[model samples]
Target: MDSRVFRGGRGFAYLEEQDRFLGGTQAPEMSFGFIGCGMMGQEHMRNAQLVGRASLGGVYDPAPKSVDCALEIAARAKGTTKPRVYASLEEACADPSTDALIVATPNFTHLDVMRVATRYNKAIFLEKPIATTVSDALEVCRLAANHTQPVRVGLQYRYKAVYAEAMEEVFGRQSVGRVCSVNMLEHRFPFLDKVGQWNKFNAYTGGTLIEKCCHYFDLMNLFAGGAPEQVFASGSQAVNFRNFAYDNQQADGLDQAQVVVNYDNGVIGGFSLSMFVPGAREELVVCGDAGRLHTVEQAQLGSENQNHLEVWAGESGRSRSSAPTYPSYIAKAGHHGATFYEHLAFVEDLVSGKATGPSLADAFWSVVVGAAAQTSIDKRTAIDIADVLPVTDDIQDLMLCGAGL
Candidate 1:
């Protein structure tokens, strides 16, 4: 097992040299095939190119226009060879040279794409949430477990340095002095305006909570350091888009919602989400007895764009001493999106046999908690995570793996 690390401006590339690429010759570029050529798909392609030593094998999208878009983007980017366009996923997956596949399709189609890729024995980069329901998500996980290669889900926030540092400080060092409660607020434009009607429907996106707030729920679980014991939430379409005009309205989706969760370790978690806010703020404020930590808010950029972290410790009966400001790289100057960094990490893990971020099971359970929050809102009751789905040893093990990865 030969391991060599390559350092570049973007980040470190850990490569494991193998017999397949010996003989005093360089290995062929890793070939990647993408299933969907939508916004996220294009970003993945660009990132793979930027990371270098990777090739675009083929791109498949149901929409011919999306194929054209992918081809055009590939033409403009450096280090990207011409990519073959396929009308169906089968054609893309059938390419023998395609080393791995990325699935960025609609929510309901994740399982189908993953199942096919697993059958082909290919590594996978799937966007979250893994599935709309717990049963389907679990089945996907089962299929992944049977696969010969790694199955990585795109939860890029886990890859950010700030989040990593914060987790180490809060959980590892116990700097937070037993997290008492967490208050989180995420504001953005509506889902329908951005993702169309499918996202607005309950059948497709699994309502706003499951589709959108799963990230926060996952983060809450990470900070609380355990599975939530209970959840109570209340929400409504208080600002229906149909009643408002685009000129005066912010977005067309859920206006406001709030959820309160209780962790098994006695930590309380509070979350508020709104699509009507004037601007975006994906910020988290973590308060502990020793100090409070705030994640710096910045715009999304290429793979490197990330939020900064600042911590303040209570001293002399008052808060004093602030953590130093970390650098922020939220967006790249060009059209390339931020998801590419995450996609490259997925590919790097596959080649080097490293554990990938956000496993399928972790993404699945995030949706589970999000679904439970919706249940609480609809029933006007406090929903326990176990009540919705029994907290088995499997869930706990999955959480541990997710946190460390």
Candidate 2:
């Protein structure tokens, strides 16, 4: 090996003898702890263990069953070591072995969990929708801004191969032609019942728009390349448990919602979400001035499976266009499972002392957009993003939004 390229950590001196010299050596693996062992948490745990890049320090979930389930899965995948289970967030964060923490708790709990995690100087990987309200989300961002450790939000779509290529093709190549209009439709199985008891209450999840469509909203903003000067959106509990309750049926009332956001620029975006789709992919389309892009319906083979992207561009009047082929980036086999690619990217940043993408500041904006959408649904009117997140120089002022002390 070249002496110039090889390096070692402090306290260890490399003694390079002959090329054939044999000695036992190993690199330290990253250790990770998971908070909130819910569905997403379990998925991440499986991925991290399978990736073999990080060892599971322990997992914390208030529910005993969840903690047991997480430990079982971790032991089966890796092996039972001295992993500890805690029923509290403080226990998880205070663990000396924990190098990173994954927050997969309810929307409302994100800020509290993040606040505690930051105090312990742990790198954080928070799940989507950052928080239930804009202010709380902004506080999390503000706290993260002061920390030197890496903080990453779960916008996994950004890590997907097809999605990345599509972005490059649309924005990078400018095939989209300024993106004057965007239409997004996502229909998945109803999460109301899927989330179990949590589905009946919007206080915890922030309804369909904040909890679910927030992803689409973030993606739309990315495609637009900037914040919307204004937004007008209208949504309702048109179908599902809410409507069923009115009809005298015992339902969980978490069914469907549609929202339309109009940007200050000419671009218009529409979102359709429901748990009623029989087959997934129901529809995901992005229309631009120059061309249109679509994902294959029912493209998801598994959580780790990559979806296919089809692009139609090169104008031939309004109706004629050529279809282009794109490869998928989903990994077929890995310990980290589907999320390893993104999670490892986050871990690498933490270990290397580098900044992670989608900074908490940017994620705060996503929460602002989500909260605005929720307000629009409540007031039955279009809400401006600024109204939810008024600009201010002081971080605390931004969080309080000029509210009286």
Candidate 3:
């Protein structure tokens, strides 16, 4: 760990600035109150230690085991301060020593938690999907937009160096020369057991697309240059057939998803997820007229996702010529690496004033697209993004343009 990694201070300048902005003083080493100290929350605590700036001021979880797991992680931490346990989400958010709140609670309870955290003007690091529905997501964003504190979503893929580099290739260097189309193939395992088994139902998690594939949808939006028209999807429960039975019923969860996005700029993006496959290769391909970039990746996370960008010139096809290998830096055998970088950016924003990162609109639309797709699947028709998001005179509106409302 470098000595001068994240510390940039002038005697509580960040706190004063934060106070001036949000009407509450925030510490330089931002203190976080954990609203849900379950599996993902524990991951956040471990990664918070990796960032080395935040203090775990307090933790609150209904489950005793979850709280214990959080404390166990904190006990092993190096620079991070030990956190106190609390009985409720409000208790944790109300702690004066805390500057921000980390809401890793269940999907349905997200806005319920945010409703409290927003009142305190505490910065927040909320996990993805924002909420189980678009209206709920919009309602929270509407509230947070009025609040003074900064809010960052848990979209860790954007923070990965390899992901950034790949984006750079398509957009930065124009190596791909105006990405015209994008496609992602994600074959993964069925739902693992949650502490409460809430994720097994679509009502709680907003369907498998919103719960899981929001990450990929986010990246697709980026590759599509934020221009979205309409979305259509079809899914089935064929693979996880055993889990859909009475006692083990995963009634609301879909085992397969095939989604296509039609961009206003004529860029088409497609996403497919299959949980039935024994072994599946996860890959993303971004293509343009000049050339293309492709990454053959492993779907099961953890471990540095060691993958290469297969660069091809002229066009993307079986007949196209392959030349010049763009190998990504191989990652060490580790799982928490992505979380650490994302948390660093979030904490760094807390300490050194907010800079551009994942926006509320980004979080909003990612879920909007997925939820709309699920609707499309159910209705058997293409649904417009605006039908879910309801466009207004806003940047978010500008982002989701193309197919007429």
Candidate 4:
């Protein structure tokens, strides 16, 4: 193992070395185009500046404000010039200067955006919850599978300091031994306002589960280590946006949900979400025969983010605890610094032409699990994965094995 590896920030050496190494790498600079230019798109713009090799190529959005905000971010970057504002999405996708595309469009428009993006055959970094419906997600997967350029999903939670280290402990070191169960919890404030209030309605956002909880489901699926067998969920449009109307439509998105998933390998996973909580906190716990691993990131009243990881072994072994964190600059880039690493991985794949990180199938299964959970909530019954995903064996194998990006 390299001596410079991140070891839960135990000492100053690891972080110092990490800063030097990540900051010093001479990666090939790559230009990127943006499709949506919404809140998330601007976030990608911010993180792209942190990536030594990534530069803003252009942006396209129906909303002029979004375009202006994205351009402002590009202008603020130290060494980068202002990005072009395209009048149409097609123009942005087909622009020769852009080497890659990042789709940060609304959830419902993903399939449509992808339909156009795939035609251009540029490496794409698509935001999560691939589409509003399972069939649409499957279609997106098919398009990505056929695209020549590498296509990757933005499941960046895999890079969070706590979760990344927890993944290393559970899968890399097998510290927790044979995993038997995985459980997760997220408590946070209600959804923030978006342009036109699209997120407040299931019709536009694919329900709360498909839109908000897919990231956690993706993480759960990865840790479960097998295809999901079934899902049982209970949720409601409890507090936020209730009795609230936009454009004569009431917000029907769920504000609370409890979901359980059973994997084919007999590993079970549970997730709890509360959108009305006072603060923000996320927890992941994995249990195995030998021991258990727990990691958490929490903050209150906009305080400093507290990221922690702990591993416990029974009487026969030792235990350890530590706080894992990224450098302050990186941490503030976006998504608690996860997006920085996500962009790093995307750029690496774009340059090397090797597909790693989250693939299209990962996006599919993540949406599948979320859709199943939404269905379970609607029907008040458990949803079988087989029933939800009734495709041919080849497609099933592709979805289950996660062969391509």
Candidate 5:
């Protein structure tokens, strides 16, 4: 139970030791200013309280009812204090008391949110799918890379125990030696409505892949070697909120998608998604020179078939034991308990002066590839990742990013 006090400014007051196990309910020392008090924002609110380590610095939401909703959730979660309700993100960023900020706004609003946050030197935890366009994403990266405060992109799956273990065994130890193809498949019900039903419009979500598939894209970059070189994709908005005719919501995003990527290293990575399918489940299979690793989760997996992982050591007819995943306390149905780990990891990074994150660039490129895929699907052609996204001048070297794991 070894620990150290983090002398960093306000929000990063407490830090978790690197060796600490996930789901340890130590109260966070830092105070947080949360932007966008929506469903995802409130979920993080619950996690911050559950950690018992974080306190509220302030909270921002444009809608009057939304602010009330978020405050109600915080109270229900038994958060230490009801934070100040800020009228705008700019207001939250300028406050000296606010140590760190968590940006959980919609896809379209991210650039504006980050632009405000960068004005201050506070540590930041920004949500995934940096922006709707490759250029906007690059600008956000440039701002963060140049800012003095530490920043982490919210690709929480990287913090999950299953992924950590898999990464170590396969890439770190070379158990699955050189990975050739990393494939992912997700079949589930159609996208549900968010507050204001903003997600139904491309103007708000930057298309379905950027809105939802960013996590999978981040993972694909992680396991499939590095930045993708080119992509070929196909999908249609044939179902869900639009074409299904069950609902009146007008939408123009893909309900089913398949993206094939060729990495610079010649490793091919692919992701298949179907929102209209029955029985929610996701399967990720990675094959290498040695053998392969496969993982499956029954959407919620519930109490019965909880998420599981399997590893095959080599091609010599050997297999590693497959079983239910570990770190269950933090492995809630929402994100396989990844929420808890992400909070802890961010806190640890803040306190310890160490940050191995879904780096800003790492986050940017996931959208970059996805945006390109959308282009490929629409135009019926193969698109190169490097061509669509250009290198920035001096503020940020785009090459140094996009490769971060």
Candidate 6:
């Protein structure tokens, strides 16, 4: 194999029969201890290899199948040792070989996991929907605030090419002018089977809004530029999982929802979600006084996603539409390539000893909005942000602008 063309830097590589760079410059910089080895946890392992900065130091999960699968992936890397199969979460956190921790446990377990992970004081890459409830998320933030190590939450949707470009157009270039409204839509199949069927119940998954739609709500908060003031939502366990039961427990996860968030900045954000659709599609629309920006990503049952972004300059400027994409290799890593960039950022921040991307505050507000929406559905009324978060003097800085920090 040609070393020049396929070097081990941003990804795995092939080595020449007799080469000097074989084990010299291609070593992974940091090793990550995985607290969960399920679907998203395995994805992080793949992306860490793709970024070529982090190696899987070890993994801890109750399910042997998950740990085996994660180890299978880790074994494919170029210059990393065989990762340890940790006996427990505490063992993973206490291992001296791992430089950081990736907490990808289920939504409900985040708080408990954070409690132990924080005690280790290792840098953490926490998965999205920090917790199942607003109060739990607030506590997670509080734990992070006291920890000395930097914490980067996994709000990876912000890194997708189409959405990233939209952010640039709306925030960087002001291409969309003064944003007045934002709309987001996601149509997809039902949730896949998990190890324990924990996701089939609202008690565990934190309802559909907090479990799945938190990503969209987070984007809405970012685009709308403030904390949501009020949320009115309607949803039900319309179709998916309605007839399903595991271990004699009935499934009650919501399969459809319509949410409208009124931001303190006077921007209205709307979201439409359907988990019973055939394939997958997500679209975002931002309208400003000057123009409008729209981006969409769609995929067939077994095909790759197609992403496109468009900006209309109204009457006074130019209009353009283009496909925003990362390298095919990177995109294949996970989450349409967003997770790869998220790992890259995580590694960079570790090297610089600086925190970037979504902070704990960002994750807290994202959950607050989703929790508020779920409560709105539960009560059949509009829910206020203050009611959801219960802002106190300690957290006052987080809600100061009612928006992305």
Candidate 2 backbone collisions, by pair: 47-336, 50-335, 50-336, 51-335, 51-336, 189-275, 190-275, 232-382, 241-253, 242-253
Residue by residue across 1-405, what tens digits does model 5's lDDT show? 422222213454254555434323456588888998887787687677655567877889887777888788667643257788987778899888877898898888888888889989899888888888888888888788778888888888776656766777677777677799999888887887677777777777888888888888888988986768999999998777664332565667788999998998988998999998766777778898888888777754233444667878755556775554644444552466677778877878888878866788778878888888888988999998867776646324567443432
lDDT of 4 by residue, 210-324 (tens): 8988899999998889889999999998899899899999889999999999999999999999999888999999999889999999998568889999999877378999999
Candidate 6 Cα lDDT to native: 0.87
Q: Which ten residues in a row are the worst by lDDT in model 6?
A: 1-10
Candidate RMSDs in Å, in order, are 6.8, 7.5, 7.8, 5.1, 6.1, 2.9
Model 2 TM-score relative to the real fold:
0.79
Q: Residue by residue across 260-284, what tens digits does model 6's lDDT show?
A: 9999999999999999888899999
**Clash pairs of candidate 4?**
none
| Candidate 4 local distance difference test against the native | 0.87
lDDT values, one for every candidate: 0.69, 0.65, 0.74, 0.87, 0.77, 0.87
Off by over 4 Å in 2: 1-28, 78-82, 192-196, 243-254, 297-306, 315-338, 390-392, 395-405
User: Each model's TM-score?
Assistant: 0.80, 0.79, 0.83, 0.92, 0.87, 0.94
In candidate 6, the residue pairs with backbone N, CA or C atoms under 3 Å apart (3 or more residues apart, or in different chains) clash, namely 226-402, 226-403, 227-402, 227-403
lDDT of 2 by residue, 4-93 (tens): 113323323445434322332333377889898878888887667544567778888887777888878777842346468876788899
Arranged by TM-score, best first = 6, 4, 5, 3, 1, 2
Task: Give the lDDT of residue 222 in candidate 5.
Answer: 85
Question: What TM-score number comes out for model 4?
Answer: 0.92
Off by over 4 Å in 4: 1-28, 392-394
Taking the candidates one at a time, how many backbone clashes does each contain?
6, 10, 2, 0, 8, 4
**lDDT at 339, model 3:** 73
Give per-residue CA lDDT, model 3, range 1-405, as digits (tens).
Answer: 333222333443556443443232233366788888877898887666655567778899999999888888888743455788887777788889988889999999888888888888689888987999988887767766777788888877675544666777777777778789999888866777777688878898998899988888988988888556799999877766444544565566888989999988999999989886655456789988878888765544443344455667654333232222222211221232567767767877887885457777788778888898889999999998778775566436434531211
**TM-score of decoy 5:** 0.87
